[model samples]
Target chain A: MNTVFFLVFGLIVVVCAINVVVQRHPISSAISLIGVMGSLAIIYLQLGAEFMAAAQIIVYTGAVMVLFIFVIMLLNAGSEEGGKGPLTVRLLGVPLLLVFLGLLSYLIQRLFSDTGPVRFGDFKGGSPADVGRALFSTYLLPFEITSVLILIAILGAIVLARKELD
Target chain B: MPAAVPLSWYLVLSAVLFSLGVAGFFFRRNIITMFMSIELMLNAVNLSFVAFSFQLKQVSGNIFAFFVMVVAAAEAAVGLAIILTVFKNRATLNVDRIDSMKY
Candidate 1:
């Protein structure tokens, strides 16, 4: 059951990830990355990280992707120029990547076959309440630091992106 | 209950995504695309972290993953700002074309 779950979302993530890399247009890549984020959120939920799943959707797909799209539109960056690199490199790279993936999957299966299966309800320690408690307690310092960092980022982005007065 | 997926499968998926990110970073010519690739790589690592959190039955892995997200968000904001500045000066987004800094 869980294998089927992973297989579906995993395939979606891989394909969309490839799309993000292969698309010439930045907008298209941004959309594909949003797809990747959605699927990864599903996988995160399957792994019992419910809060992370929600955060992944809300942050990565919703906020970050919107930011990307806004930048793309603002910049008016059309599709990339064609013929990015040599024909030989493009022709041979696909097959080489296939072989690499095949080898990696084989090795991973061989190594983890005996590590037992991962059922849906394996470890349920990733709830929001748990994460919140941890965030405010053990990880409090980092949380505060991150807030400060975000403020700095906002300031820097505004300063750099705004039109010059002079 | 039905048979579950192996833990390794999740790890393998993460590895595959990370490889694609690396490929994008290397193959793409656009600066924004390259930055997107880096985000993809960060996401792949986040998946791995959550997977390991499940494996170890600990909350710390998720904590680490959260921190990674925070860092990535910060990086993206600052990076895009810098990109904006570069575009203002150079009038292009192509990595190869932005060669004024070269020796």
Candidate 2:
């Protein structure tokens, strides 16, 4: 069951991630990124990070992606101009990327050879209550700091995005 | 009984996603698409974090992933605003074209 869930959602994530890159228009890419995030949420559930899964949906797919789409729309972002760049990049880009991916997988597999298979229900500490407790207690400082970070981001965004007065 | 997925497989998937994100960042000319690629990379890392959290039987990985998500949110807000400013000044979203500071 766990394997099946992982394969299905994992496939969705990979395909959508590729779509996000391959699509020409920014809006199309944004929507594809949302697809990637949604499938990742399900994978999070399979991994027993239930709270993270919900937050992935609400914060990432819901709020962050909405902001992305709004920016694309407001800017009237058109499709990328047609020109695949120079010959070396066009010819070698994908093959080099594949090599890089293969190298990363090889390294990860060798490093994690001793770890056990991930079983569903094995980690029950990912519930919201558990995460909230950790956030408020052990991670209290970081949590408070993130609020300040967010406040600064809000102010920065407003200042940067507002109209330029004469 | 259900088949077991090795922990390395999850890491491998994360690697693949991260690589794709890198590919997008380098190959795509559009600024927004490039920014989205950065977001994709962040999500890929978050997956790895959660998987390690599950492996170690600790909720700390999930907490870390939560923090990553919060930071990604803040980043998106500020990043989009920056993109808007860039667009207003340059009137083009192509990353290659936006290079006015190229010496």
Candidate 3:
């Protein structure tokens, strides 16, 4: 059951992630990324990270993706113009990417061979209560700092997007 | 009972996604697509964090993932604004064409 769930959602994530990169129009890419996020949320649920799963949907799919779409619409961005980059990159990009992926997978599998399999329900420490406790205690300082960071981001965005003064 | 998935599978998936993100970042000509690729990379890392959290039976990894989400949110906000500013000034979103600073 767990394996099936993981396989299905994992496939969705991989497919949608590819779509995100392959789609020419920014809106299509944004929608594909939303699909990727939604499936990843399910994978997070399978991993027993319930809070993280919910947050993934609410924050990423809901907020971040919406923002991306809005920006695409606001900019009226069109499909990517067809310009095959430098000859070396155009010819070797896909092959090099495949090699990089193969190497990374090989390294990860070898290094973590003994880490054991993940069984759903084996770990219940991902509940909101547990996460909240840790956030307020051990991670309290970082938590506060992120709020300030968000404030700065908000100010910077507003200032950047605002109309230029005469 | 169903068979368990090895932890490495999740890690491998994360790696594949990250690599794809890198590919998109380098190959895509549109600035928004490139920015979305960066977000894809961040999401890939978050998956790895959650997987490790499950492996170690600790909430710290989840906490870390949470912080990553916070940072990603802030980054998207500022990044889109910058993209907007770039579009306003340059009137284009193609990364190849917006090379005023490239020497």
Clash pairs, candidate 1, are none
lDDT of 1 by residue, A1-166 (tens): 7878888899999999999998999999999999999999999999889889998988888888888888888889999876366677678777777787788888878877776677777889999999999999999999999999899988988888888898
For candidate 3, give the lDDT of residue A99: 95
The 10 consecutive residues of candidate 2 chain A with the worst lDDT sum are A82-91
**Once model 2 is optimally superposed onto the true structure by TM-score, how far is the C-alpha of residue A2 displaced, in angstroms?**
1.4
Global lDDT of each candidate? 0.88, 0.93, 0.93
Q: Report iRMS values in order.
A: 2.2, 1.4, 1.3
DockQ of each candidate relative to the true complex = 0.63, 0.81, 0.81
lDDT of 2 by residue, A38-106 (tens): 999998888999999999999999999999999999998889998577789889999999999988888
The digit string of per-residue lDDT tens for model 3 on B1-103 reads: 4498899999999998999899999899999999999999999999999999999999999999999999999999999999999999999999888998998
lDDT of 3 by residue, A36-147 (tens): 9999999998888999999999999999999999999988898989987889998999999999999999999889999887888989999999999999999999999999
TM-score of chain A of each: 0.85, 0.95, 0.97
Q: On a 0 to 100 scale, what is the lDDT of residue B49 in model 1? A: 96
**Residue pairs in candidate 3 whose N, alpha carbon or C atoms collide under 3 angstroms:** none
In order of appearance, the predictions have TM-scores of 0.91, 0.97, 0.98
